[model samples]
Target: MGEEFLVNLKYSPDIPHSVDVIEAGGLTKYYGEFLAVDHISFRVKKGEIFGFLGPNGAGKTTTIRMLTGILKPSEGWVRIFGLDTGKDILRIKEDIGVVPEMANPYIDLTAMQNLFLVGRLYGMRKGEIRERGEELLHLFGIYDKKDKKVRSFSKGLRQRLSLAMALLPDPELLFLDEPTSGLDVMSARLIKRIIRDENKRGKTIFMSTHNMGDANELCNRIAIINHGKIIAIDTPEKIKSMSKGHTVIEVSFEPFKFKPGDFAYGEKIEIAGDKVRIHTRYPDDVIKEIVHYAEKNKLKIVSLTSRTPTLEEAFVHLVGDESE
Candidate 1:
């Protein structure tokens, strides 16, 4: 089973273990007088998925742009694959694949044609393009649509095609900006699976996402940026531990009328659809109050569960103060 699984592995023998595939020091970007990215420094190890997360107006986009050479940094420096991102961008481009947040295929072309164009741009041989293109089409579950015009495809399919084009080169490193954003459930799930598989096949991926669950699930390490600065960078567990260390009690009752004041121990209370999400340091006390409230109000507890802090909670804790 292990041998079979390793059959598709493409881990590079050239890059040694623990080597930094990407290094940035004091990377900053400015739009006129407004600072878009402050001095930020970080490293991405080879063969790992590193996540960059932030709110909408945060510096995530600017940082990614600088990393991919879309926008030159106002200050600091970036090195990818041991080559300077600014000075050796053309050379660096050869070993990297980039999928922007709003990646798109040529609307006038078919899916297969789009891949062919990417292959040509990468200077791949015709035979190699055909074989690799077919493989990617099948991998992305868009094989049946290879001949279909991209203009007629749905958003999910277009995103799939964009990803396929990015992967067509089989580059050692991938820069994906919101790779699964606005995608359908199945499409999003499929893309996440592909991310894991690609990492297993020895690809280093730098991805940015607003989805905390995706960051927690997919990232080997995460960097949270706020107000043009990186506030926290660490493994998801370690970062989550940095939160107020509250236990989250998710409970839903029949006809819940309990107000936020009802749970005296709850530090934060939020309404999630029909459920109440309560964060409390004193879980025992909050749980008892929930039971008492249910009993007195003649409410039936539909479900109740408790878990430790999540990345979302940690993220909120870390960036809440900076929110406008």
Candidate 2:
């Protein structure tokens, strides 16, 4: 029999070993007496686009810096592709790419030259660098602007060039921080398409962004952090459902005022504006009660609908703050 047959090749392990492309255990970073990251732990699987979300000063950047080896953690561990980011800095860098919150391409060089320079720094030969540069320029939709000085490029173009530089090494992992920060709608959409295409090619992406919409659209899994602490981490659907189960429906009527205490409101009810939103396992029952009250008092119905939970709603619920 062949070696494959002799080894019980008909059967496979229940779980594959490629689950964790990035693993962190109690990862923490301290600057002086302040804790920037407070012992957060999470795992990202291969080919997964993991979204890291937090408001400004929420330690999102600090966590990314530590994972990319720009800074070391004060406590705990971070492993990328099973290699310690701290101990295997050089090896890890060889297979990872980072797009910082800011794109600072060399202003003195042309767009093409910037990419070529990056390729050389990656130890690629001249011919290889030229080939890769052309490929990347085309990939980023800047091939026509290759000869233009980076200083003259628009912010969107510059961002694309920076991403091209990061992709020069064909890394298995990519780290992007606020990549579409200053992009217009069209540019942002293009970048999103590029990210999607890269992920389709089996690249693992670790992304941090203030754009909740993009995070909801792109992430395979998401983690919400606040004040350096992780509040929730899971598939977007699961995270949203956690809030959905406690969702409230609000019905508003003109010339009728109702106090919450009048009814045995569920624990998840809130009073806002001219409406009283209440949460329950049975929205129909709540609606019936509201209709009964309105009819009893002969109230005029203004608006009546069940409020479904959005990712934004889930964020506000978990973060305990509403977005401006």
Candidate 2, residues 1-324: lDDT per residue as tens digits?
Answer: 345432422112432234577899999988999998999999998779999988899999899999999998999999876778878778778778899888969988998788777777788888887888898889788999999999999889999998999988788789998888889998899899989999998788999987889989999999999999999999887777777435567778789577767556454667778887776667777778878888888888788777556687788878877444
Runs with alpha carbons beyond 4 Å of true place in candidate 1: 1-18, 250-266, 269-278, 282-304, 321-324
Q: Which residue pairs come into collision in candidate 1?
A: none
TM-score of each: 0.83, 0.82
Q: lDDT of all predictions, in order shown?
A: 0.89, 0.83
Error of 1 at 184 (Å): 0.7
Q: Which runs in model 2 stand beyond 4 Å of their true positions?
A: 1-18, 248-281, 290-307, 322-324
Top candidate by TM-score: 1
Indicate the TM-score of model 1: 0.83
